[model samples]
Target: MGTQERKALEKQLRRSQILDAARMLLFSSGIDSVSISGISSKAELGVGTIYFYFKNKDEIFAALQEEGLALLYSKICKFIEKEPAPEKQLAGIAEAYYRVSEENKDYFDIINYFLSSPRIFFEPGLKYQIDMSGHKILKIIQNTIATGIETGVFKEAQPGRFSIMFWGTLHGLLHFKKLEHTILENENHRDLYEYSVNKLIDAIRCQ
Candidate 1:
């Protein structure tokens, strides 16, 4: 590649290295314990280099969140495309979400961490970007529900409101997974998740 292109590619690689390092630290230690210097040491790069790519630990964390959300959105889109019917598409979306959590635990953990901690804050622009990424995912669900209604597969309702409830229900169920051995010792977590998804679908399905 040309000199400029090569330099750009190198820069992107460096950024990925930083993010990877931060992700490792996040997994090893809680976010409260993560720091810029720790990430620099973990990546085997200078502190200045870490700052060159990211302003601070928060920015690095936000970048990771953005990456995870983008991955989720892409996966959801692909899952939706593969299904022929709107009801099936919603099921596909739920499966895609579970697969992502299983396959990308680091990303999922960081996203979950930030989401559960409302006290954590980001700059307005950064927060907006992350929020928009999330909104895109929700919009897909809302649009699919609207399509199902239009086709007479689902009952008429406010797509936006229902979308929020649907997403929140799935997310909440997934979060309860940690308590499985205690609270759900007699139940299969995956079965419970699928059952919840089906119930939600049934609630909206035309009678």
Candidate 2:
């Protein structure tokens, strides 16, 4: 409520503005084009002001990862909950993962930055937080497998191995789906995702 607190809050808001603008550009285009001055212009702040909040481009990107991932994690949680069963929950989680990438490709690009282009992304905190926070998605996978096994919906299966395999398979499918231009017109894209999940679902089902 004091004048000093109000001033500090305003400063924080302006810095957040810069990060949001930078994230937009990074997702729309790519990180190669996002210069300090460029982000300042988009944010309607001064380059000096951006530097005041962030030491360099690396810091800006890290903050973007933090903020954007929070949005994405919320999306996954919201979508996954809409499903009614453990099997549908697994399918929903996989679908929600793709939805996040399509809806907020910026955050997706930030995650893929470390995977695809390793040069600019080298922050330890970013990696640690992402993996830790992403554990929820993994937990969903584990729970789905456990449920399937328990109810004989999925019987005599390697839940741990299924979790890893399912995630790895979907991640690769999505990565390539996003990367290639020609893959755009493929009619089976949607089916492929379903088929991928169903393959594992079938593997675990009582047979």
Candidate 3:
């Protein structure tokens, strides 16, 4: 590459470093405590460099959250690739969600902030991500429902209403299973996610 290209690439690398540092800090601590100075120090960038990339901490957070969510979606796409059939895809999606939750608790913590927290909601210039998290998994369920209609898998997928019901079912059940164990001792948060999904599939499966 040319000298200018090299310089541009180096600048981009620095920006990514800042972003990565911010995410790590937020995940390690809570978002409420992260500061531009801390992130810049962590990234080895000048404080002014941070401003060049992001207006403020909130903007940095918006970028980090969006990037992490895209990673989740990309991972989901990989899980979908493994399942050649719709039924299997639904199961894989359930499994994928559970595995990702276990592996990236920090990411899910951030996800929760985006989902239910007032911080993301009330903060100006900070865009909260959409509730397409379940959509990342429920695409499989929705597709299965649609394909079922064609090949007699389900009676019919009420497109107007079923997506919400189906996705809401997944979301509600997952959240309950995720938190139930913490509230009570010796309660194992097992494959209730997959089981709940299977039950829904069973209910909707066409005879």
- Candidate whose lDDT is highest: 1
In candidate 1, position 201 carries an lDDT of 94
Q: Rank the candidates by lDDT, best first.
A: 1, 2, 3
| Cα lDDT, model 1, residue 32 | 83
TM-score of every model versus the real structure: 0.93, 0.74, 0.74
Tally clashing residue pairs in candidate 3. Answer: 2
> Against the hidden true structure, what lDDT does model 3 obtain?
0.68
* Candidate closest to the true structure, highest TM-score: 1
The segments of candidate 1 whose C-alpha lies over 4 angstroms from its true place after superposition are 1-5
C-alpha lDDT of residue 180 in model 2:
50
Tens digit per residue, CA lDDT, model 1, 1-207? 999999999999999999999999988897889899899999999999999998888889889999998988999999999997989998988988888888988777877877777674687888988899899999999999999999999999999999999988878888988988998999889999999999999999998
The TM-score between candidate 3 and the true structure equals 0.74
lDDT of 2 at 6: 100
Write model 3 residue lDDT over 58-165, tens digit each, in one string.
777776566656666777678879866666665666666666667877666566566556444425434523435435444655665577577765676674366557
Number of clashing pairs per prediction, in order: 0, 1, 2
* Ten contiguous residues with the weakest lDDT in model 2: 113-122
